[model samples]
Target: MNAFGMNAFGMTALPTRRQLLSFAAAALAAGVLPRRAGARPLDDVVAAGRLMVAVYRDNPPFSHRKGGALVGVDVDLARAIAGRLGVGVEFMELTAGEAVSDDLRNAVWRGPVVGGGVADVMMHVPYQKEFGLRNPEAVLFGPYQREGFALARNPMRMTQPMLASLPDEPVGVEIDSIPDFYLLGAFGGRLRERLVHYMTIPEAVEALVKGDVAAVVATQSQVEAALGDRAAGFPITPVTFPGMMASSWDIGMAVKENSRDLAYAVGDAVTALLEDGTLPEIFRKHGVTHNAIPVE
Candidate 1:
């Protein structure tokens, strides 16, 4: 969701606040951690009375802090899963790594060098075949939400709400995001000078509100949250960049590879939450639409 994690939408993401973690090599080394190491089994987790959930810091509508309290979709999902397991929830807020692979190593299987030990389970991980295969040390599963991109435009500025018009109109995008790359590279770089960069999608959407840009391209949830009551003035629709990598994906959780039992238990809990409509409620509470459940 960049609503879920930074760099979740792109294969080659731009450098973020958490640059390529300097400890990646050591954390990802084959023998750095004993198999299963600190990852608690399902039984142990219940015994300890809490599930350590790792979520991205400052990821609004997903896991951001509000008035010094953590409240968002992913936070609520973690609490729901822990509630189902009869345990309390403990959060391990994460800074976005250069890529999701690095996040898996530092938060799911191996602890980062700076030393907040690995969490028992991490939320908002990309659930994809190639990505899962590449990070075999972590078992990625239980995709609860489907994420996609959208365009939020000021109707007063752009009479035409089509992707084709972006080349000629000013558009706002989060710096180093899928939207930024696509807008910069698409149409033979014609949109490069027309692009305005923001540190976050909400900022870009805000710029759209202020008429600083004709349109803002970002994850649907981010645009929705930013637009709030103002959404009526703007058209928000599912959008795609023709040749951009991963314009949409399913977001799930990750655990140590040795913790398959934990994965199964969490999966069952997630399925129950989705079936009973609790997940969608969480999204609605955050003012973000639950687009659709991830395809199995």
Candidate 2:
């Protein structure tokens, strides 16, 4: 059903600003956080009278820290959910070394021992069924959206070839990522010599900027994030790739395992948020127009 059509329960649209604030306050006092996804955490927050959420500030399109506050698509959706649950949010700004896979594992998976465990979950996290399998404690909650991927060239490089001469130039990808996997499987070792592996896209772009490679592969979202994340100036122009080859991926809430009830409740809230216009609006604001979940 369409978002408007699904709620026959006579629900009020969106959430009031005040309920959200109260929810955040209650969450912190109770000490229920992102990784604390069991019924135990939910019950704790319920007793404290609010849900506390930890959000990564100013990640753009996903979540962001703005003018001393946190806001973004994920923030909006999360806030709306908090309101539905009568919970509160406590935003946390997360700093990570590389947008690489390993760093992500270290921060989200191994972070509870440190003060970094403040928030409940991270935003803009891409989901993989395989990843969920390996990290049994983690839950992939929703298929947020699919994004555009391209092979970009350094504007100043004369060695980078045009689309017609694509095979002659090598493509650079972060090692051990889907992009690298795709290239290897598709080319059948023909272009392996031209394949360059960097630990992260920023490093791949660095190689490209130094005329070390022809193209640096990245998603549109990743590329935009890289522009701000990198120390050196931007250096990639989009090039088309095989549409069926790793064209789509998932993004969802990653929570600790055995938290089925939490996942269901959070998923239901997410479902409701998506049914409303909030989810699409957040996507549009973030330049992420691709839709993941269907309207209820």
Candidate 3:
């Protein structure tokens, strides 16, 4: 029998060691195996019996801590992928770096000088061709969700649909977020005086729900999660500005460029999760609607 203890269809299986040795000899003779020694990230993960995943901390509905445990859509997804790989998972919560490139460098390939080191995979990476070109060391793939900004406003405060109505009252947004920057300069800087910045989108949305701000601009998922049942009273609408080139973009996972095998494996897992509707289910469990990206 073969090493797996299975015989071929209608034939006896070859002996284990002998057949393996013969195949190795043939492979060596044919130069099928490279002479250079290198360690694959996948191999390391399998050998260590654990997969390390990098996820952003304080981002709700994606990755965040809840009830004294790290829990979110991305957290569940990472655990699912690790289960598929038959390995344990270690989630490394990290604050987002200044830019995606810095995150890729610090989390995917080269770990920070002080931290525990790079993770095997990082979720919520922007799946843009231009971004991929800029960061060659990281391979961004498996576009799972398409995310975009939306404006959620308290109906009791402002009933106007136009963006010009916000000057009388302040509008809230996450500090340094795309919506914050967009509103800061929108309408020839007219809204600048009425812009209020919060540390996170949830905080901005909270202010809107409490009637502290007339409106809040943030991602659709973030707005929905923050508003919860109060969302029924508020209106969440897609937002478009003069300088906004794209309202939506796809988010994916990233791995070191050298870890193509792991990337492909993770991609397959993501595809399977999407096909079976597990990914969307995870998002729904977090009280957020999942906007899936069309697979190309």
At residue 293, candidate 2 shows an lDDT of 48
- Quote each prediction's TM-score: 0.89, 0.54, 0.82
lDDT tens readout by residue for model 2, 86-137: 7775555555422323223333443432334433444555565655563454
Report how far residue 280 has shifted in candidate 3, in Å: 0.2
Residues 128-194, candidate 3: write the lDDT tens digits.
Answer: 7766875678898988878777788877787865566664798998886667767888878888998
Query: How do the residues 191-213 of candidate 1 rate in per-residue lDDT, one tens digit apiece?
Result: 89999999988888888888888
Report lDDT per candidate.
0.81, 0.54, 0.75
With a 3 Å backbone cut-off (N, CA, C), the pairs that clash in candidate 3 are: none
> Candidate 3: minimum summed lDDT over ten consecutive residues — where?
1-10
Q: Give all candidate RMSDs, comma-separated.
A: 3.7, 13.4, 15.4
From the highest TM-score down, the ranking of the candidates is 1, 3, 2
Candidate 3 ranges beyond 4 A from true positions: 1-40, 160-167
Which runs of model 1 end up more than 4 angstroms from their true locations?
1-6, 10-24, 27-37, 294-296
**Candidate ordering by lDDT (highest first):** 1, 3, 2
Superposed by TM-score, candidate 3 places the C-alpha of residue 231 at a distance from the truth, in angstroms, of 1.2
lDDT score for residue 272 of model 1: 91
